[model samples]
Target chain A: MNPISHSPLSIPQQAYSTELQHHLFGRQLLAAEIPFSLDVLETHIEQGYVAKTFGIELDHCIRCGNQDKQLFYTFPCAICRQLCTYCRSCIMMGRVSECTPLYTWTGPAYDFHVPKSVMNWSGTLSEGQQTASDRVKQVILHQEELLVWAVCGAGKTEVLFAGIEAGLLAGKRICIATPRTDVVLELAPRLKKAFPFIEVAALYGGSDDRHKLAPLTVATIHQLFRFKEAFDAMIIDEVDAFPYSMDPSLHYAVQKAKKQTAATIYLTATPSRQMKKQYRSGKLQAVTIPARYHRQPIPVPEMKWCGNWAKQFQQKKIPRPVQAWVNERLQSKTPILLFFPSIAVMETARPLFQNLPAVYAEHPSRKERVQALRDGELQGLLTTTILERGVTIERLEVAVIGAEHEVFTESALVQIAGRVGRSFAYPTGSITFFHYGKSKAMVEAIRHITSMNEEARKRGLLDG
Target chain B: MGFSMANCYICYEKMRKPITWTSLFLRQPKSRICSNCEAKFAWISGETCAICSRELDESFRREQLCLDCLRWENNPEWAGYLTKNVSLFHYNDFLKELIAKYKYRGDYALAEVLAPFMKECLQQLEYDLITVIPLSKDRLQERGFNQAQALLDILQINSTELLTRIHTEKQSKKSRQERINLPQIFRVTSRTAIQGKSVVIVDDIYTTGSTVRHAAKALKLAGAEKIETMTIAR
Candidate 1:
């Protein structure tokens, strides 16, 4: 027997997307949906002249990524590569490189992929993906515009492979714009392996490879300011994400960055009411994926209002059902994640759970805490919404302290709920909400999930 | 009241809309003989330095050069390319007061009145395009708008952001040599677009000519064929 095989893997381990598989096909996928027009591109090129020459000045060292506190020209690290200063840590690691890719990209293509070494990796697909992929392919081939709407967990990333393949095959430049840096880092390696032959550029706040300026660029939306109608196709992911959605400047930037004849695509999970109104009015076009690939119904976690909750916990007593649930998980030894609304409450209740012998952790604690969670060194973690997106932990039971907190919007709650029941082997799980007051948003969120799960079940795509 | 009545020297009200009058006389209750101490100043008129916009004091004063030419700080080979410059009044008390109010007082409506004077100041320095000195981002945001650009719009000239500031500091506080020692601060943008273009650099004043000199340096680097400067006051 394999010594590491004391417990069965809860989910079928997915094969690492090899670098060869990435290159086997030639295209790329974008993170957002953007509009394209030749006129807009020309205008951007004309207007962005001043922005091109504006020199960026930094007050401190770039090597250690320290800012403001460090002085210029002093404590220079020898690995110094760019105009910016480097620090001792970067010098020791040989990481002192200039900040590159400030100017928009030009030339070369490559594939990207997520390496298999990452844990808790389970991606789902839907029939809509093939249709969406085909649409993107057609848009690129004909230089058209497409709008895509996928429900949470609808496997939107995989759909881009086919579109990127077409861009590479045709030798046209492509770019994917997102609002978050974490997403860019997460997506870059995946694309690299998925199409290794094509040179791909991943741009974010401080990525080292930014200077290469590849033909295919993956960047945050703010970086688009440096470009002028530069891409043959521009994809804007999470079209409904905050700050990006609210800022007209970003929308204008995307429009200005695409070629007059370029293809533009938009992707979103929870499009705003205004977008829906426009789509209904035919001012915009859309395609949606409403089901998960697992074909299992999305689980609906019921909320229980535990009034006077602090009083109950102070009596050296935990709620009977909640205690029973934790005890069951302890007996089974399944790692669990307990979410709280604030760090203060987590501190107060942390001791209550210490007697159970399960390691407890929360965010904003320390870098050590996050590492501990990743290493699976802790059995249960109490956290805030900081971990809502871009984090994956395998086979964990999940619970929430206050589902009705105003901070947990419909979109946030949905994304939080998405954390559970992700793997094929462990496609079913329990989610409990301990709320002091019930909110309509909570009801609406649960309803939305049930409807999507019902649709997935109807399509026979649920995993378990 | 004779001194006040002496302000009425150029008093013809029907002088074809009197293009750009000094704000000292125009922005006040019209007792107009040039009210601030009633000092007489030469208004830039006929043929002058085609490049520097230096006024011709006399018809026979050689078509394109001025008294300041002996100390001019640019290449002579490029000297004759620009037209005449019309500086409305010497940088005196009355003009200085109006400029302060117009530039720092958030008085944008004053731009409508000032634009024509700026236009009249350049009556002899014929230019194909006009551009205002570009403000650094920090300064522009603080002031809400560029004053020179606001007035230039009234001249109906298409403008571009051709210069970028390397650093910005108050010029009045710096000495002349310190001003000269200041590095050439403007960098050219869209070099190919400005090739062989003749441009008139417009500003509120012409103190020491440093800002215009820097701006002219950028325009020259960008291949501007001829550069002339025009100001409401020198």
Candidate 2:
């Protein structure tokens, strides 16, 4: 059995009473060198822990040992009696309210299932996707480690189903971890429908399935902190997503969550140079996916320069070429997605599009705002890289305003382009990047897409 | 030549499995208190301003606010009402020692023991969202982590990194007056996201309460209905 680690220490036990130590341990048998005597522990058990730690006085509670004006008396909760001033005013008192519990989300409850018609859906697999699925299938069957290197829109998620189904059939516990909630929410329902019988969980921030640790979990990588060698087979989706890719701690998290006997599979649209090198050197088993699901070549976005767009925007004059392009696209009623380099530029450019009638929005907003982008309620969506992954809309043309800004790195630009031409209905669309100056990243992004298209074409992936 | 020596060291450590500190220390009977840092002082929970952690006498009342928190004087637009505030420690060396391990060290083991202590400190109150004062993007990038985020994560509380610091500067270098009078240094990127939401600001230490107060002011400006603050150390 793997040893489970605990959360960080908040209070020094030596400074605390015997009762506090018992409370920290909880009822569950925790494996640790707890610094306490048996007699002291027994004495604490006789009287409750919270009362000893926080003494109540004359209708007011001694909150962190501060007794000021009288606060409302709330009965002791299972956890503690000392509520913060904010919790004191809560309608439910100090109880854990309906705010989703922080844990993994397994498939819907036992009785819940999506309709059967949606389960057997299939689409054309790109050469990159076919190669990835084959590699993942081999990994799960043989219990071997493998890495799948695909460019964006190479249909990595569909390739995962075969491997996940293999794990489920074999009765082995599996977890697919990513670094973002958007990906987890998107993948959870898809995975659930694909393997309806097997229990699948989606674990991310604000998910309420803590106690429901299923055999399989689709989780954001941050939630990996809670597990210790708990997974038999682990697949990390979007292995190159931000923060996760940048931070070594998250990499440690991936390694830590996998059981010794488990096979780890990494699926990424854009593999880091280090990973690519490792694959070439035979240090990692590798597969490549280089085309969209529709087998159409990824549309290489054309780059245009808008000299001093920010300065021009402040003076309330939209660039003629850019304005003409927007007018043409909007006249066609083609929903557009305009990417900006930074929030500052996005805010500056937002007013320019207001009366123009192109629908615009930002990330981390209400579901309705994001929904507007997909429902085509807005003529266009103004966005940062926050909408780069796990979002797909049909028949949308994308333009990057100020694409040459330092924020749009080679990888980021590649991802932004990947957002174009995702769905089968809109296999190809016009993607133009308006910049003040041409950048190496911009060229690299175009080159990256063209190269992938070249690979897919060489494999005879494209149909006339 | 180095391979054999390294192999021998690895073999030696591997042979000594199940290392036991209890067995080693059993021979020597020792006191419970930390030997290095003597208990020089006890918990001195004296009368303090409920809002700002300022020690005060009987003159302070719920209606009569602290000088920093006086709504009309400090922030005229916002009412600036917090239910209550309190602290167990004075942000001294002892609290700093504990915080270093809790934050930088990835010592989440300490949080399991300490979170309840924070919970105990959160006296009776109603909070809608548990929020932490966000670290500047540059600071977060340099630190490779947010200490406050880690603490709240361990507490298993619902928190949002909503209020982003637009500018990166050494906050500690400025006086309380400079901090209050400081220009609109922070911005609420997610206004409607937090509108009508109740929030409790969590931080490692609260000194003058200016930082949390400013954060609360920003949240309020974004149309947050109510605000409160709690810290590990006062």
Candidate 3:
């Protein structure tokens, strides 16, 4: 029944078999989702062209590597006619149950052809960016893990162009995974422009490139759950971002998505406490870029006591100091971003700011409002911590209206401060922390910025 | 089934079942979904068609039947096959997404999330036997479980496999005319079990009412006396 020698298979069957092979290569797919009939898949299995394993094996989901017993539940399966266990952790991708099998191509691997010249980026990297870029290339070539401890707005993405190009020249598959869909949407276009000759598949929740095979893939880390041992090199952008830093399943997914010896480059502005400890202990190799590409220091946040903002908000009044800060930015026509502790507080205080646009995680027009702020259509915007990272607005003044709130972690506050002074023409801006009371996170955030500035000055990475 | 910290099946948020004087003494049924996600479901209420339970506007409430049900009843070939259908929720966007995740995505736990609603509607119906609308062999294997049967299983209700279906393309892909005009797809299984008995057909959703009607016709021809249908959504 083997069709390798063109046995008696019909034309359509042959075409489907070839198409299945191409799609299943470097990807793990649910058996039910495979378009071809089981008979054809069985033939491929007999010919050693495909391998199938239980979707959930040994009480863990093979695709997403979820092992939590609480996340696994059983249902009476119609096909098996018995109780079958399934993983709820990755059920959003598609249910991976014990009775189901995950299909992966086991035949010859596809060779990705790369063009002679892959790097098409015209802009030059600064001194700090160039040094970090060379280190990334070295790490990829040696198949080692490297943590790029770059500050925000330090041209981290530019540093990866050289490493990605080198990996492509070596005919290796590379994947750039980030925690947020916003980062994937932002990076996909930039990567496509940088490597004009190669195909780049950007995968997210509802992305249309789910089945496309390309040499380079940029996707949300959740999308990496669908792949297994697929890439030769992996770059995790925003490594310390939410859901990725807190969720172990995502960490397991990243580990499962790459080859055993694959190089991993972790790019993060504020490393997690655990990551920081590991780097200091020499457990993980590292490179640090402390200065922005404009050869300027990060904007330090100034603490200003705006007394009892919550009580004032209950009375439908903006705190005196907070009101003064908004007036200054509005009068000077300086575009500003005011971060609130929560969406409820932001909405309550929104009408107080002349009904300026408020952007949060679930705001419907968040992208348009941010774009409007960038286009100078809006003088200022009120936001939550969702804009803490992955957003850069030049000459933008930022303030945390309730900096003492528990949501304002040290890393979050630093990232918020990093949103200012991003462009070369405007390398200095003011950041104010208008808090009712001081918290340990607020103090540490200030110290974090000051130390980074001092480190940059000591290394002469900043201009005199 | 037991009280513990459970994540919402839809949003994955940690659902805290509030404790109260009543909850302390009585065993409350744990919710599988959070309140926020639960609030999004539009419960079918107010005036609805007598036959298919499709929601009707105020102007159409006097008609007592929706236009689709009227068309079904006007045809002698299909009239009176399905005695009545009681649906629990409206087919809003949220319910559409919930059903898609449950049926197409193989999220079997959603059956538990939907069990209470289904049970509340089924309790008021009088029937000798409860049966799920059968799925074709290909579809059953692909989805791993029959959605209607899962609802019954979650409620600990015993349902007889009174009907078998022939393998065919998905009903959603067919147009309304194509669905109404298709050849008989269900065959009665074990005629003795359904003969001279009133049967209630359980299904995930009652869209166009063709699927339940076909099942009812097959059971009716095999000697069932009365045929009624219960669905989660209209």
The prediction achieving the highest DockQ against the true structure is 3
Highest lDDT: which candidate?
A: 3
Score each candidate by Cα lDDT: 0.60, 0.63, 0.88
The DockQ score of candidate 2 comes to 0.02
DockQ ranking from best candidate downward: 3, 2, 1
Model 1 CA deviation exceeding 4 Å by range: A1-126, A142-145, A242-249, A308-324, A344-351, A355-371, A460-464, B1-234
Q: By the TM-score metric, which is better: model 1 or model 3?
A: 3
TM-score of each: 0.48, 0.53, 0.93
Model 2 residue B227 CA deviation in Å: 26
The window of 10 residues in a row where model 1 chain B has the poorest summed lDDT is B1-10
**CAPRI category for model 3:** medium
True contacts kept of each: 0.00, 0.00, 0.70
lDDT of 3 by residue, A84-200 (tens): 999988887788888788888887787667789887888898888888999999998889999998988898999999999999999889999999998999999999999999999
**In candidate 2, what are the lDDT values of residues A1-464, reduced to their tens digit?**
23464322433342336333322321111111124544444443443331122223443322211232321223212122222221121111121111112111121112223333323446556566767787787787677888887777766788877776666566567789998887898888988877666567787767876435476688988776555456778898878888788665567567767777788898887777788789989999987777666778888899887788888877887776688888998899888877777776677777888633222333345466557767877777677777766667788788888888887887788888887788877788888888888999899888878887888788787776
Q: What TM-score does chain A reach in every model?
A: 0.67, 0.72, 0.94
Per-residue lDDT for B65-135 in model 1, tens only? 55454344354632443343445556666567656655653333445546655554566666666777888
Residue-wise C-alpha lDDT for candidate 1, range A1-464, written one tens digit per residue: 57666232322343222332232122111111112232422333344311111112354222222342311122111212223432222121222223211222122223333332322223543666777778878877788777787775667889887777777677778899998776788788888776676678898766776444465789888666545666889988887776577665567567766788998888877666787788889987777676655555656777877665556666766666667778888788776777666665656677788632222333335445545665777666667666665555567667777677776777767777777766656766777777778888788778878877776666655545
Q: Calculate DockQ per candidate and list them.
A: 0.01, 0.02, 0.67
